[model samples]
Target: MGELANCPNCGELFVKGAQTVCQNCFKEEEAKFEIVYDFIKKKKNRTATMNEVSEATEVEKKLIQKWLRQKRIQPGSFPNLTYECERCDTQIYEGRLCLDCAETLQKDLQQTDQPKTLKEREDENKREKVYYNVDKENKWRS
Candidate 1:
């Protein structure tokens, strides 16, 4: 027999490998899951968009996207389960992190002017491109 674990939702005892509630409670969860899955599966639902999923399921958009990327829900099965960024709310189909967030973070990181000696700057300049922050924008300055 497998080790025991407390159900995440109801705190009942279940097998250790289970991450969610036990089988009895899982039925209730499955009902909700079916609602979401059904909503995503239908053609009208396919065009429903992330905002519609948020409104219908009350599940956070980010989490829906995570489920899609993790293959907990098959992409081919439901063609419309795409995730958007929590910050900018941009649609990102591939990964949990959005491209805009990545670009913004990259720009913010590059904006920090690290102090370096002339020789160090020259060596760095030789090895790679140099970026500078001007008017709150990142620009590659030669």
Candidate 2:
């Protein structure tokens, strides 16, 4: 069962599902996306940059950036199409962040999901042993 939600774009109450916005807004976005796609697919504009395409299509830069992140724009065909990395703001052809940022993020994640080995649990259980000499005064009481 879907819950009622106020569309973020139009504030109209809508059944929440895969879409964040209402039907009207979704249709508008689809139309805008088609316009952007048609503009970029033109042979003369195939190699155009994001800003160039945005200016020509008269669409918001963020909307085009969203398409790039969604992988709707192919870098192989449009080599100049690039989006900013979410972390470092570096130009990347795909994904939310660049490769370097992604690696650092992975390293920062704690490995609590990994199970402890038998040797590791045993080491934690062992305590340091101490030896006491009762015959310290008697030098060679072997």
RMSD to true structure for each model, in Å: 13.7, 9.7
Quick one: best TM-score, which candidate?
Answer: 2
Worst 10 residues of 1 by lDDT: 133-142
Lowest summed lDDT over 10 consecutive residues: which window, candidate 2? Answer: 127-136
Total colliding residue pairs, candidate 1: 0
Q: Rate the local accuracy (lDDT) of all candidates.
A: 0.71, 0.84
C-alpha-based local distance difference test score of model 1: 0.71
Q: Which stretches of candidate 1 lie over 4 Å from their true place?
A: 57-66, 76-80, 84-91, 94-142
Candidate 2: segments with Cα more than 4 A from true spot: 110-142
Per-residue lDDT of candidate 1, residues 21-71 (tens digit): 598777865676677777787777776766788789876665566567767
Measured by lDDT, the strongest candidate is 2
Question: Candidate 1 at residue 95, lDDT?
Answer: 62
Please give, for residues 19-48, the per-residue lDDT of candidate 2 as tens digits. Answer: 778999889989999998898889999999
